[model samples]
Target: MWPEVKIVHGKPTHSQSQGSVERAHRDIEEMLGAWMDENKTKDWPAGIKFIQFKKNRALHSGIGRSPYEAMFGCPARVGQASAGIPHDLMNHLATEEDIENLLKEMEGESNDLEDPNSHGEREDEENTVPETVDAVRTESNEDVVCGQCYTVLPLGEEVNNDGKCFNCERQGNIVNERKRSRESLEKQATKMLKLSKKKFSEVQVGTTVRVPIPDVDRARGSPRNVLAVVGSVEDGLYKLCMCS
Candidate 1:
C-alpha cells in the first residue's frame, strides 16, 4: 500500500505561522516604548512615524540590507546633508545666482519651521477629522443622514447600529473617524487589563467551569457557582452547557 500524503492547514491562531510578523510587532513595541520613556511622554503616535523611518533604514540580518535599500536600488535619501549631490560638482556647476536661490529656499524652509503659525496649522490639519464629523452632524438635514460623511440615507438602503449609511459603514469611515491614537488606546487597554486582572485556570473543551449567579438569582438564595461544561472553543470564546 502506498503512503498517503495530506496537507494540514494552520489555524488562524497558530503562532508558528506568524513568527516574523509577531517579531516585527515586538520590535515596534520595544522601540516605541523606549522612545516614549526617553521623551517622558505617552504619545506613541508622534514617535511611531520616526520609529518606522528608522526601522526601514536599519540593516536587517535576514535580508543583509536595509529594508529601504532592498526595496530601492540605493540607501534611503534623508535630509539635505545626504542629498547625494556632490559638493565639488555643485561648486563647479552652480552659478552665483543658483547658490543665492538655494540659500533663499533654505532660509524659507528654516523660517517655516520656526513659525508657530505653521506648526499650529499642521496640528490643526491632523486634528480636523473629528471637527469635520461634528460639523457634518450639526449641519445635516432632518432626513436620515450617515453618521460618517453626513450623506442622506437613500430609500431601501440600510444604516448600521451607529446610524452610518451602507456605503459609509462598508468603508468603516465612522470607526476610522472616531479612532484615537494607537498609543493612547493601547495605554488605556493596558490600564484596563491591569485593573481587571484575575487568576483562573486555563479553560478547554470539556472543562468544567463555574459561573457566578446573577444578583437577582442570588437574592432568591441561588448557589453562587452554577456548574457548566465547555462544549467547544472558537476564537477565544467557550461554548458552555449547564449541567443537568
Candidate 2:
C-alpha cells in the first residue's frame, strides 16, 4: 500500500480565488476616474481624472482610519459625518426637562409677542366661565412638540409623551416620544435657521451661482438680482426666475 492515487501537487500558475479578484479589478477600473473632488479626496491614491475632467474617479478605502478602514481593514478616509446632522446641531441638543419648561412659558404666544420677563401675578378666576377655561387650555395645548416631526404639531394633533395625539392617533414610536414645549420648539426653530444659514455658507467665498429667489422676498414677483454671499437667502423650494 505505497501510493493509492497519483499525487498532483505543483505551483499553480493563477490563484484559485482569481474569479472574485478579476471582477473586483474590473469594477475598480471602471470607477477609477473623476470621482475625486474634496468629497473623494480621502481616496486620493487610486483616484483618476483626465485633463478634461474637473474631478476624478474615486476609490473606496475601508481599512485605514475611516469607517471603511474599521469595517474592512482597508486604508481609506472616513466620509464626513456632519453632512447629515444639520450644521448647527450642536446647539439644539437640550434635555427633555429644559424643553418642557420652555414650552409652558410660550404657550399661545403670538410670533410677535415678547417673552414674559417677570412672573406676573395670577389672574383671578372668580367670574371665569367653563368656556373661558376651555379656551385657555386650548391655547396652551399648542405648545407641545412632536419629537418625530420635531416642530410643534398642530393643536388638534399635539401628541403626548405616549406618542398619542389629541385625535388618539400615534405619529411615531411611543417609547421615543418626547415632551418638548413651545419654547423648545422655538429654540429648535432658531437652530434650524442657523443650520440653513450654514448650508448657504458653502457657497464659495465671493463666488455665486444663479439661485432661485422666493416670491416673498425683496424682489417678490420679480427676479432678484442679489448677491450669493452668506445669508443671501435663496428659495430652493420654488422655480422663481425665468430660467429657473
> 38-128 in candidate 2: lDDT tens per residue?
3566575645443212111132232112332233232332222222333344256476554445454445343324435422311233345
Candidate 1, after superposition: displacement of residue 215 in Å?
37
Q: How far off is residue 125 in model 1, in Å?
A: 40
The count of residue-pair clashes in candidate 1 stands at 0
- Could you tell me which 10 consecutive residues in candidate 1 have the lowest summed lDDT? 174-183
Judged by whole-model lDDT over C-alpha atoms, candidate 2 comes out at 0.44
Per lDDT, the best of the predicted structures is 1
On the 0 to 100 scale, the lDDT of residue 79 in model 2 is 28
Q: Which ten residues in a row have the lowest lDDT in candidate 2?
A: 51-60
